[model samples]
Target chain A: MAPKLGIVAGSGGLPAKLAEKCRETGRPYFVLAIEGEADPATVAGAPHAWVRLGAAGTGIKLLKEQGVVELIMAGALKRPSLASLRPDWRAAKLYAKVGLRALGDDGLLSAVIKELESEGFTLVGVDSVLTDAVATEGCYGRHRPDAQAEVDIAHGFRVVDALGVLDIGQSAVVQQGVVLGVEAIEGTDALMRRCGTLRREGPGGVLVKAKKPQQERRADLPTIGPQTVDLAHQAGLRGIAIEAGGSLVIDRDEVAARADRLGLFVIGCRKPS
Target chain B: MAPKLGIVAGSGGLPAKLAEKCRETGRPYFVLAIEGEADPATVAGAPHAWVRLGAAGTGIKLLKEQGVVELIMAGALKRPSLASLRPDWRAAKLYAKVGLRALGDDGLLSAVIKELESEGFTLVGVDSVLTDAVATEGCYGRHRPDAQAEVDIAHGFRVVDALGVLDIGQSAVVQQGVVLGVEAIEGTDALMRRCGTLRREGPGGVLVKAKKPQQERRADLPTIGPQTVDLAHQAGLRGIAIEAGGSLVIDRDEVAARADRLGLFVIGCRKPS
Candidate 1:
């Protein structure tokens, strides 16, 4: 018998894409959507149940009922306010065990993974199901980065590495050896918009997205899609670069097509030696 | 006879305040205002001349004619667009000597200082004329930062230090061991407004401003004033902490009074050992 997969869906198009992949592969799966985070329309017509963000116990119970022993988390969940949380007994216990108050998003996710594993649910990475989406090293579009952009890419990598260590962010906008902006709580889209406003008349910067050096790679890998290419072009940036084999290049062909049309370079850079 | 002083005025109330101090002391001085940067009203009734940002030759010639030997630069000047600049022979020579294209604001300022000194102008620090505006080490408001705010302050200092090394901006907002924002070219006021939008229900972060580790201190020292306190309070921050001796606390009494009334702490922190 084939293994039954479970997707703990959050916001954005990733969850929908994952569900479509499951359908195409003739695989059995279930979707557990978090209220206010996962779009109901995206998971419609699928085996799904809605649970609050803090209802870890409730989510597990629903998954078990549907015979879900293997799971993957998908999409982004903006960190919710403390007052909005309604943690159940299981979540409360886990929080106490992990000392959740002191941990950042990565720490909290790590603790949650450990807790779920202890409950006998095996966690699988999203890439296992969406293998084709993974980015490969080298340029994907018609345009290639010039020498200046290459230098910027190297500088951006170092910056993102340092930021990862502090668990601050995974993206940086750099132009001509100067860092234009570093993303914190604001998402990539907002960061790109701000960079657009700050662009000078000359050649623009590159948007480099990489996994945090210490990031738990099973989930939360850096991702870019066609929209990302559009945003970069709109921001007057010359190119978009992501970590090779460490980021998802969603809609790869479309992303390449868009980049070519926009005269932007989309390259997957190798991690610095 | 006291050496006649020259004020290289930029935009902001600081130039006006410096003029007031010169008047109070009955000192002989001249203000060489940048055409688009400094307001004419600020230096009214004083010996002043308007010159474009690129007119370094004209400025130096005027200062020499007025018998000005000592000079201090005041206020902020947003970097001008290339199209707006009309670099004369002197400015062009200075730029070529300094390789100004590769430098950030501080590096350019340092090169300018060296060039001015080489031309026989003694560059004095703004603090020499506005000693009262320099922040002293200690708390100045009724409210002291709670233990958490103190920790945030220490963390903020480290963040700012790292940022300073990169020639990034000199301010950071941190809360609960997480950095909420880091200021880049957008500057302090804009940074504070963004932080206000990111604040949650819990205790807010503290704003820490410090000089870059390698900053040329004769000009461009970090500064805060009554308006800074207001912005911090509006951002829901617990307090404002600045580098003592390295930062200017303009309108000291007014800042303290505002902080006290707003239940915020205004502290001048000693540099970490």
Candidate 2:
């Protein structure tokens, strides 16, 4: 029997791609796709079932039924509206055990992993299989940062990197040498829109996105794509600096094409010492 | 000779009031006020000379000229547009040694204090003189928190406190348990306004302001007053939660009056565990 794996699919095509890669490697895998978030096309390409994000126990039971002993998480259930769906007994018990720290995505996922592991499923990192797709250092789009924006980028990168190291946030909206906004749970797109209304002047804005030092790299990896570039353009943000190798650039070719057309500077920055 | 204290005045009446209190105690003092930010009333009330916020060398020289010995920071400063401020030789040199971290208010002030102490002048905290004025726990305005808002406030308080603990920021904008913004150098008003747009579709937001656990109490106590409440109302925020006795409620009566009229929740939270 080929080695079996399970994929916890969130939003986007990444999970579908991962499944295809698994097929190429001749590994039989099962996918637990999040309802309303996972792409239908992606689900159709793999052996999968639709489930609510909060119903972790059901997901694990299905995986167990399929003889899956290992799991990989891909994408994210975008701004998961957790207001409606009720958790099952396994999820409720897991919630009671995890308490306050379990409020955020990181905590919620870690708790789910622990529960699955206790049930004899060994969770594998998505990166262990998708290493080649991770981002790389240097200019990624047609536009290179001008000297002034480069200086702002360097300064902004340092500030956002420190913010990330503290695990307070991942992205900061900076113009010139001053920070206008730090992305908390609201995320980057919301931050850019905030900037558009704040300072009517200044040379648009520079956005810095970096990975936290303590962040789990495989799950919830910081990502950028054409949508991000488009959002930045709409919100008047001129540039973005993302950590190389530690961040994911979804649809690299399309994202670069969009960045190029928009004349936006999208550079992959290495972590500063 | 009467005991002399130093006042590092920023942008309001608090510095002058603190100076008057010093005089009442028969303590002679020197006031180093920020030129563009300090109220003219503050300048008139204290024995002072004004200098730009970033002009560290000039500020140090003036304080020394006034025979200043101990320092206490009071009031607030208009956060300088760092992109425009031309740092003098002294400030630039300090930046070379300290880098971007030195740009934050606490970092810069601490650096200044270190330099002053090296020259034999001691630094005193504002709390040493204004302890009686610190706001204690409980309600201040017409609105008491609904159970849901209280839950959100508790969640907001924890997140804001964590932000402070990391020295990432001292204020956060929250709504329904989601953090909408975290303060960087942008300050509270900017953070509130940013959140207003982000949460426009939902209920209004909450502003949680607190001092960092490691922050110097005397030099930079968090403050809120009528204008702060007014700004929150203007930005569509529903409530304000500040740490009790860790902050100052400037013009307390006026703040209460405004909060009452606006139907806003303004309360000092019990010092967090």
Candidate 3:
């Protein structure tokens, strides 16, 4: 029998969708919803507990009490700061240990994953549960990338690779052979919207996303959904290119249909090793 | 006597400042003020001709007519587009030849430099005329980068170096070991303002500027002025770091004085070759 799962929900509908998947499969799941970040509806009908991000000690205790041996962290959360998080004793110790020693968010996440494993919980990636979430190499919709867009996608990847080498960002926008913007702490969503206004008159931009070179796969794989298609179209973009097998496509069919409806190409390129 | 300098002025005070230097030094010069971008004050009392950016043919004609033998391009200009520029016959020819093949703005600039040389004209960097414009290695003000700021500045350079590898941009903002933002089509001022809101708690960010790896130094060297110090301060940044010997710091005294007054460190770093 599969061990009962702990959904460490943060924000977005992915957690809810994961819960629904577990319910359909008759797999018992308990949600440890992060206070403030996790959408409330994620725990509406689930056996769960709300815990402040800073109070990981209590969260761990609750998960153990609920008999959750398998864990999956979902959705997005801000990079925690001492002032913003007000870490409890356990969290404080972790923060002090990892936060100072790490150079980037991925380092801190790796530390967290190690801590969770040492606590006897085996952490799983979201894609393991939502099998269809993993993106593969191919054009997903009716629209295909033109020669110019193909070049731009290549350019975008080079830029993303450079950013990742610094452990900086996973996405970049390229239009007419010019890098329009890069995702930093602002995120892919804002990066797309900002690049929208910066586009030149020629071929529209391409939104390219990939995992950082040193990113912790179990913690954060780059992700896009139908909403990403909408944002791309709104940003006057011509296509979307994500690292194949290194990124997630939430609701793939919906994303392809949306991209088709918006006259945009959605292709997955193999990320260089 | 100084080879009859031709100032191909773009937008901003740099062109005007360069013109003033020529006037003060009693060097014969002519200003080829671009139609839409060059500030009027730049040529208010100088030997100048207003020419559409698309009318490069006419500008070249006027430069020869004025006996202009040496040229210097100064200040900032948007990356031109066919729709926005409405290229003239000669400009159209040049654009058609260079636009499609170049991967980025620097490539286009390099081609333009080659074209000017083919036409028997010499091009010079901004630092040549404005002797004090060249930034050299050192902390320029009362404040020095603290240990944390020093680390962030080093981190910022890694980000900038990665950006340069792709010919992306000249600047990036990093705070507490995290990249806050990078400049692309949005320019440096906007990059700083955008980064201000994205900064993490603890130490403020540092603005780092460097030339692209294959940049056309004579055409578009990385530059900063007193206004940059103001922007850095307003962005809640602790300091400014620019590539020493590879970037220009206009009005060095003013930049230093302003940085001192604002309690910000303005350092020139030795760029890695």
Candidate 4:
């Protein structure tokens, strides 16, 4: 009997990609799609069940019934307001244990992961199932960062890294040595849009993305895709830099081709440990 | 002979207010306004001359001819783009001495101050002229910060203090220990507007303003006015906290009245040394 894999899917195409990879590799898998977050079309014609964000107990029950032992969490779960959630018995118990300390996304996710592990489920990282989605180090487009852009990239990485340490954000726009913008609750796209407004008639800035130092890699890894390239270009940025092996580059070939077409460089940077 | 006061006026009513105070006190003063920056209406019918931003030598020459030895720099001077500035010999010399280190506004101002002092001008702080404008400690409205608002105020101060250490900006919006936004190149009003957009339906955030740790107090001091109270109300904020004796409260009575009317608190806090 094949070992069953269970995907606790959220929003975006990563969930579908993971499911497809499992099918192609002849692995039996089921998706527990989060309602209002995961697209139903992504898991169409597959063994899946829909559950609300706070229905951890029900999801575990369904997975156990399917004899699933391995679990993978993929895609984004937009932070919902506390008023909006109706947590089931398991989620309620979990929240009671974590208490107010679980206010941050990382804290809540960590608590959930601990509970799942205690329940005997082995969690796997999405990158392990979709290796090609992980960004490789170095430039991937026809246009590479010029000397000035290189300086901006380095500065942007420092700013983003500092921001990550504070757990405030993971992206920043930097030109020369001045930080033009920093992301907070507004998210990356909004930050890029702001950089667009602040752009002057000169060498543009660089958008740097990196994972938080204490981030749970298996649950949520920083990701970029074709839309990111477009947004960066629209923001008049020279390039994009992501932490190598720590960020997901969705539709890599398309992202590279778009970067080439837009004359923007996409590089993977490795911050020194 | 009484040494004449030189007013290096920038935009905003602060310059006008300072000039008026000097006039009322029977102190001789001359205003050297920056072209393309200061409002002509602010210095209307006053002893004033306009010099382009980069023509620092010409400005000093005018002040010397007026026998202005004591200089006061006031008002908001939006950092102009590099290409827009047309530096004269003196300005060029100052920039060469400062080199690329003058990228931030504080850096450029510091360099300018050094040059002025070297040339025998005694720079004075605006607070020396407008003593009543300085904010005093304690709450100044019908309402005071509740326990949660006090916590948010403390958190806001810490965030702004950290940002100041980085010399980024001097304003931050905080709610329940979470920083909603921090001002960068976007300025405080924009940060407030962003907080307005990010505000949740609850006991809103607090706007904290403070002087940078290394800030040259004689040149730039954080300021809040009646408009700030209106904006805070519009943003659904519970209160505004400013460093006591380190910030200017323009239209103080009106600001307090407005805050009281809007059920918001205007507090002057003293961050311990």
| Per-residue lDDT of A219 in model 3 | 74
Using lDDT as the yardstick, the better of models 2 and 3 is: 3
Ranking by TM-score: 3, 1, 4, 2
TM-score-best of 1 and 4? 1
Which residue pairs in model 4 clash with each other? none
Best by DockQ: 3
Off by over 4 Å in 1: A100-102, B39-41, B80-86, B100-102
Q: Write the per-residue lDDT of candidate 4 for residues A6-82, one digit (tens) a residue.
A: 99999877898888988999999999999988988888988999999888899999999988988998987755544
Whole-model lDDT values for every prediction: 0.84, 0.74, 0.86, 0.83
Per-residue accuracy of model 2 over B96-146 as CA lDDT, tens digit each? 776653245566556666766777777776767766668779888678877
TM-score of chain B of each: 0.95, 0.84, 0.96, 0.95
Worst 10 residues of 2 chain A by lDDT: A76-85
In terms of lDDT, the best-performing candidate is 3
Which residue pairs clash in candidate 3? none
Number of colliding residue pairs in model 2: 3
Alpha carbon lDDT at A271, candidate 3: 70
- The DockQ value obtained for model 2 is 0.19
Separate DockQ for every predicted complex = 0.37, 0.19, 0.58, 0.36
Q: Which residue runs does candidate 3 get wrong by more than 4 Å? A: A99-102, B99-102
lDDT string, candidate 3, B30-95, tens digits: 999988889998899899999987787898899999998999999776776566777879888887
Candidate 2 positional error at A117, Å:
2.6
Segments in model 2 whose C-alpha atoms lie over 4 Å from true places: A1-5, A16-31, A39-48, A65-70, A78-85, A101-103, A141-167, A199-205, B1-102, B105-133, B137-168, B173-180, B185-207, B212-221, B226-240, B250-273
